[model samples]
Target: MDQQGNDGWILVETLGDAPTVIAEGTRQRQCRPLGNVYRGRTLALVAGTIASVQASRQPARVLLGETVNGIGLVVARPVLGPGGDVLAVQVFTAPADRSPPAPHRAAGWEWNLSASAGPRRTRWTQEFRKLYGVSDTRPPHAYFGLADLYRRVPRISDIAVLMERVDNARPGESLSGELIARRDDGTLRLVRFVRRAVDTPEGVTLRGVDHDITDRTDAGELAVRIMDSDVAATVHSVAGVHAALVDSYHGYAIKWITAPLPGLSAEVEGGQVSLLHGDDLGAVRPHEPARLPGVARVSMADGSWAPHAVRAFPVPGYGSTPVVMVTFSAARPEQHSQHVGRGRCAVPDCQLA
Candidate 1:
């Protein structure tokens, strides 16, 4: 996935490798370095994902950083040998929404305003009942008043406005709006509604439908922030790794920072994976922040290790990824000289457990 799926799926390949993490890339495109095994610039994200697949040997899905009013994600499936060992990984990416959203039938409702009597009556479809997790025990022809309707969609704070809309609506007129609905289980959903007015034997009635748009709305909001130039783009586009962390002693919440931000901020279903470093991570704690200011072996643009000084600090953020921040810097001459000939243990390109 190019730009870690920020640019959508590009080239796909299959290869073999050891448990040891190594990076090599000789070219650049779309604001990122391209490596045969991994193009995800965020070390924490790439390192975490690869290490996860290598351990579980199962396919994993992860967010591909941020996008403009859209979402990016990649599904990495492990290629296994006959003996059941992971040989390589194949990743499929979605940089933009390429598929139509799944459909959800809008729940239907009917309001009869002709009743000059005590209260107007409204009839609702089974779809509406089920949408709010309401158990319908009444006959199909039953009628419910405005009070009952308000109780069902408690999250619609503007209940009075809704009733007024129906009351003032004229025959042959139509209206549309968005509302927040809450189910019996305490789950909240975003619903888009449409209403049309027509005359009937009973009286002028308003026909309405409520369709669920929660998933689409949520994804769109996330995409906008990610693609926003001032928000997540800086982390992804800047030099060195910019990672998000939950707290000290935890794994990377998402830290590609290579292109500049954590690409795997939205982790897999089970839990988040921490960066592979040990005590160094502890040093990043907010309460007693400290910088080792030592040299670490980073994965170079040409797929090699280069000495760099590590600088980290905490900052506020949003989404599934945690708060706290970390940035990497080039090592000073003395610090670089001190770690000139260290072994694999000294490498800090994010090694996962």
Candidate 2:
């Protein structure tokens, strides 16, 4: 209640701790319509204010108004009751200038690479260098080539399966695999790589991340090797119809075998899986007769089954996953030498009877 009533403005109070308009001294008050603003709002709504409103204090800041008559520096304070508790908020707006705030920069590294023929240009952030231990003096592009990357990998031959998967992946598809690689110090470490393809107007972009998994792979491989060695006998992936022994090593039947199981072999070359359908007829599947460790029956190409035995061991330097050592031998039964000439031993364990 003032002389002109223009400056006195509106007076608000609380009823039972709830804010309510108790008095409106002037129609010129611009903070009135906001009376309803507190209806559904509590002290939690302080975040919407220029500064936090307190029980006995007012926080002042420049608040830009939508209308010409409503522009100003707004000051709002919580009106406390006789019990020193917040009962209502009294808002006052004054004249002030308006200016836009500055832009904010986020923390961390971000990169974008163009998908194109030949070596694609990549934008690497400072964090990228720190992540891969890229030397400040050496350029990052030196490590971009996938084949060149293979040269740095000590166990590239072992991760052939994983590498084939990476190479055969389609756009937008994601693949993750781990392999042992040599760092700049010539130390071999297991690293996990993840890649994703993003289709763009220009072309497809390949995004990737590499992480060190030496601790994890070492622990896992140690456990597998311990368990594998503890087993006196084991059966590796068996040879089936349309299977060909690609490569054999000492103490193992075949290091690599190409089988015709659908989906089992894709993009994997060499002894992983090969087709024997062409004019390569004289290809005889080599059989190691004297190396049998245990007895098991396997199917032959002629549809007939024959007894065979195998012994498997782990082959290191392959990949994060252990390669099995497999050895196959033909099984023979005791026969009658003099009378029957040949007789199958049922259960009587006879030797040349």
- Top candidate, metric TM-score: 1
lDDT per residue as tens, model 1, 55-160:
8989777765575233465555554432344434434444535532223433556777674532455666666677777664666656654434544443212343
lDDT of 2 at 221: 59
Tell me which residue pairs clash in candidate 2: 158-318, 253-326, 253-327
Q: Using Cα atoms with residue i matched to residue i, what is each candidate's TM-score against the true structure? A: 0.33, 0.28
Residue 173 error, candidate 1, Å:
1.3
Tens-digit per-residue lDDT, 1-353, candidate 2: 12243332233332222333332332222223333533233222322452255433454353554433433444454543222333344444335553322211101121123323433223333333443444434353322323223333433233455534544445656554555554445345555544455554546554444444454446555434334322222222322211212222211112233222233222121121222221221121223342223333333345434443333323333322223333334423221111112222211242111
lDDT at 149 for candidate 1?
Answer: 55
Runs off by more than 4 Å, candidate 1: 1-102, 218-353
Evaluated against the true structure, the overall lDDT of model 2 is 0.34
Model 1 TM-score is 0.33
lDDT of 1: 0.44
